[model samples]
Target chain A: MKNIIQNKSKDLQNEIDNYLKCITDSSLLFFEGAREAYRGDYDDAENRYRDISELERRADEHLKAIQYKLYAYNIAPDSRADIFELLDGLDDIVDRAKKNIFQICVEKPVIPDCMKDDFIAITAASVDAVDILIQGVRSFFEDVNSLEGYIKNVYLYEKKADALEEKIKRSIFQSTVVEELARKFQLRYYVEKIAMLSDLAENLAKKMLMYKIKRII
Target chain B: MILKLFYLSSGLFMGWSLGANDAANIFGTAVGTKMVRFTTAAIISGVFILLGALLSGAGTTGTLGALGAIKALPGAFIVSLTAALTIMSMTKAGLPVSTSQAIVGSILGWNFFAGATTDYTVLYRIAGAWLFTPILAALFSVGLYFLFKAILENIKIHLFSLDWIIKLSLILAGAFGAYSLGMNNIANVVGVFMSVSPFVDIQVGDYFVLSSLQQLLFFGGASIAIGVITYSKNVMMTIGSGIYRLSPVTALIVVLSSSLVLFLFASENLQAGLIALGLPAIPLVPVSQSQGVVGAISGIGIAKGGGNINTRLLGKIVVGWLLTPLCAGILSYISLFIMQNVFLQKVFI
Candidate 1:
């Protein structure tokens, strides 16, 4: 409420917005890499992963700046830790995006023609989950009452991503038509990693809710 | 003229402390929120306070004069100095202090020393004002909040424009609050000096002239301006964020309500009107601006939801409020005794 406190929050909010933009870009880049991998374009997938790594590094820089500012600024007790916790959790979403995309580029596993759509679908769902999460995070600072609705949408997309992961993993293991056992396991791992990104987003939403409670109550 | 000015020093000091401390209530939120610069607030407040002191500071001094008279020059000096010292000490200790109560206590001490009978009815009325001023101000704020909230909801104003409006409104209300503060509480600063004023009517070019009381108010106003320029920021920060987080709208309401209470109590015509209409007169009492602001803020907190307030800090302030008069009274009494015996000064007429 105080002007001095709000002035401090302005720089902090700017830092958060920068980090969040990078996270959003990384999520979209992760989805693009998954599509290239499904098309048997390893070179394109590698380029996208490199792009995601750059975004991740930029997001990390912003996160560091924010942490430093929080240390420097004599912020309000209600907002200081709660906002940092929210930023930390959001930053991890970018980390997961980077890690998931890198795994796809490195493994270069064989994908069945039939399973390609499902892989792309899982990637789409994961990115959607993070986008909804971005909106939920924005709502935390703006309209707190609207955050629950965005989080519910995040959970819905997460569940869809999980169901697809389970279905695809089971088919890869069961069919005798699949040749290498090691390759089969790797396929499951890659699919599971994509699903993990959504899970991380879901986790962030819940942790954000926790921090919001700690702040107001 | 020099002796008259020297005698006015104590009142000037009390005025300085009042500006340093009470300016927080009027402009703290605006300054702390960074919505207004401290210099901007100080300038607006100082000019308006000077205007209000010149125009409206006389009436309240009449009631204070009735209480103990403090008719001798030495007694007035000692009483005002004791009140000023009490405020400074409490402020340094990081406790909320009231200029009004300290002045009353010092006057009471002087009353005892000068062998004047205390006017019990005037004292009771002042005591009554202290009891009800904050409560009444809080009610005014609560009612104003809901009414303003409803009116604001209907206007689909842009956020930027709304921010500008609120900023302008806060400055305007702060200026109004400054005027009301000068009008009501200036008496607390210089009321005792009125009794022993040395200047008679003076004429310069037959058109421009000044009374002794006018000189006192002018000197008092200048001291408060100096306090605002030099010392208000720390107190403003404390009251702005320390009490609770006040929004722009909430800050405006709190200030308006505080001014409302001061104005209501300060107006004799309004009091007489109420009495004529079969209603009890609201006692004309000098109130602490901080107390009124705190009460309004807490009132809004209750109106919204009730659980987040810091009860311990509030408890300390409550204790300080209760002890303010007692401390000032004892300090004044002892100081007056020492001035009479140790300094071998004439303290009473």
Candidate 2:
């Protein structure tokens, strides 16, 4: 029974790592699609976003599977709580991405407008943050030494995303045209999604750190 | 004492209705400005109100009994319940009216039913209080706007830094308003019943303390808190977007000023304070919550070059203020008469 519990814990960690990796890849691809839309490569952008959305859906499915496994194993209440929050956060990011893509496909506002560059920068920074989040969680889960640097780096990236978003909002308000207004509103939504995604990643990293302290991970 | 039980139960219902309907007055601007999300605003408002009621809401619990014309505990209970039912029905019909006036009107109806013992002087004072609450709210809004403008000019700080500071201030102000609502208005919603009946005796070591009134205020507040969180989104949305444009500073100032007015008037000696301040003897009843908010908004409007005030909306709200009590009194009186003649006389009596 002890050996089985240990093995199940190891499997849970592996599943988490794979989920973060997939999220990072799709996030980068999503940003690339956003950049393409700015460059007037509408077809390429649409295709890339569609691809990212499909991957995000699969990632969510895997996350749900892991949650089911954890429940089946009668995971400690705290560990179960952490998993639920992490999965929910992960799913929220993907859902935001999917929604943004839908808005792009349907609304099709003029590309590379006032908010375009800021949106790209925020998403790129968010992707970087989520990448470090995976590393931080992995280190903490494995009881690897020197996890502070990874955690601090994730905080720094999230802060950077926040600053970028602020600057973008200020610029959007400065412009007065109707088209600029539409672009600004859309850009704000996407930037907020990226920031929120990073925030969730940070929460997961914190939970991992706590789990390590409790020796539950 | 037995009659007081019905009064207490009715007051609890009134409190629930008050929380459900009037919370929007405190939270609408913040939610409308997108300063805070509606869900966060509601939850925070709910939790804080529970805290406020449990702690500081005692002052306003017996406000109507002290402020209005209801003759006895049974009369007060009937008045409160009738007013509450009228307000709820009106709310369902999409007219956002005042719970304060409803309670006052229902008490007046009860007085009329029992004959001329209702204090006309107190009723007049209460009417005057309604008239003044909005005016004071507007004055405070205007005053705060001027004060803010002078400070901004004198400070000579970076605009970006100022924006961040103002946003933070708005958040804090919204939270404070939530707390104050819990402390002050939560009583308006549930306090009547607290004074009406008795609760189970609670044992403290060797001594047993008996409550003369039901402790249903807590439950009523909870119910209203739930209603506000669940159904108040639409009202907040309507007010937030449709009302006048407000800068972050202006919004914060208006809320702060209005909340202060509510807090001050909601004091234990609010009646005496009004007299001391040489304000007309406003009956200490729950006046119109919407009126106070409108007055504050208008104050901000006057401060921000006067174009921001939507006169049409203000007029409509005033109409609601006028109609709510009269309708409650007439409807409740008729309903009570029917119940007395056809229902209660045949059943309980």
Candidate 3:
């Protein structure tokens, strides 16, 4: 029985590791795609978008498998629902990353040189927030006590993303270089889309904090 | 032959009730939290309970015998019947009840009816053990709680591995709890009938022997096992979710601590070992598993900073401790009178 339980746990852990890897890979892909788009490398950004889309599909498959195994193996019956919610929240991070990159690929907005650095900064901040959130989720499974520190980092990166997002929007509208209102709105839309990743991460961090409290023995 | 079986049925009925109610104390949290399936818990608890009764049930039975030896079969039957009735009535009224306390009270009533002198020393020992059972369990749980907490904090085990550990621990603890329950409370089921038991000792060649007392306990244990198989699921559910929502880890600790308390009071080998070590021997007496569980939970509450300790529930348990025996004693005396006079049966010799 012990061996059976250990094997089940190992199997579930492997699946979780795979799923988390997909999310982490998507975040990296998102950062690269956003940087490429701002650099006017439309073909490279489009390729990154395709890679992230595949990862999103794989993550969905992993999520379904994980949900099945959790019920089948009857692991942590009391916390199963919370675990499902946490996994769904994580999957959403990758999903949001995919959608944002897809939008950037299709819209192909011409980046003004003055706002390009800020766009890259916002993407880096959002990706960093997501990276820390992934670590927090891993810590939730491995060492819940260490999870609080990771969650704090996620929040910090999210705050940076928020500040950078506001700065980029203010600059796009205030600068005399981009005169068209429609072009400014397009830039603002891209900024919010990228910043939304950090928003999702922040919300997930709050939920993870509550889940951690419930997990305390 | 049939008449003897008829009289023994009351004791079997008592055993059934014990299994129905007390098995919950052992496996309730595990089943309630869905950590273990009901079928698995029942099978494990049933087998261990019978094994414990067959192997080690004599110690606590000796203590009960010393309390009041019901010399007549009819008297023993009446005592068991009245005790079982008391438990049923009290449980129906939503009052706390213990088979150990009820049986002792019924035996005292038998003594009164038979004009026999009650052994106050033995009575005091039994009563003292009853009072100490929960406190001992409480102390054990508190110590175990800290130990487990420290180990978990230091180890930082993964959630999946921890869940596996808790599930396995709950099963092991439930088995131990079932064994201890059988060892201690089998006395309450058949102890009174030991003096009048009809079974003869059997020897198979030179290797195996089964005494009449062992035969009696075997039957009593079977009845308890049957009760577990048939009626314990709902009780387990109620105990698991209704009475203080215990996490799987806390449930393991509670079962372990309570089982240790029951084993201390029931294991003759442990008692002998203590005496051999020049320490005072632990008394072999039937103690309530319900009391042990309650005490363990209270210990946990205290360990968690004393909030959520229900003093009103504690007060009600105390009232139950006092009231169960008194009610059983009165019922036993009246029932014994009716059996002797109205049924024209000899209740005493």
The candidate that achieves the highest TM-score relative to the unseen native structure: 3
As a TM-score, model 3 comes out at 0.97
What proportion of the real contacts between chains A and B does each prediction keep? 0.00, 0.00, 0.55
Per-residue CA lDDT of model 3 for B140-246, tens digit only, reads 99999899888877787789998988888888888899999999999999999999997889997999888899999999999999999999999999988996589
The TM-score of candidate 2 is: 0.54
Interface RMSD of candidate 2?
A: 21.9
Model 3 regions more than 4 Å off: A1-6
lDDT by residue for model 2 over B1-349, one digit each (tens)? 5644554666666665666656666667666756556777787778766765555566555665564433344545566678888887877765657777777677666556655466666667667667787888898888887888677545544322343455456556666766666666665565444444346655657775434322454665576677677677877767766653454566677778877766665555665777899986433344566667778888877876888787876776777767888888887677667766765531111
After superposition, which runs of candidate 2 have C-alpha atoms over 4 Å from their true positions? A1-217, B1-13, B67-77, B89-96, B156-164, B186-188, B191-195, B198-201, B205-214, B269-284, B345-349
Q: Write the per-residue lDDT of candidate 2 for residues A1-217, one digit (tens) a residue.
A: 2322133455565667677677777767767776676667778878887888788878887888778866665333223566567556666666666666656666665634555667778877877887787677555544335567898888898889889978876766665642456666876666676677678667767766665454210
Model 1 chain B: lowest-lDDT 10 consecutive positions: B153-162
Error of 1 at B11 (Å): 1.5
TM-scores of chain A, one for each prediction = 0.92, 0.78, 0.96
Residue pairs with backbone overlap in model 3: none
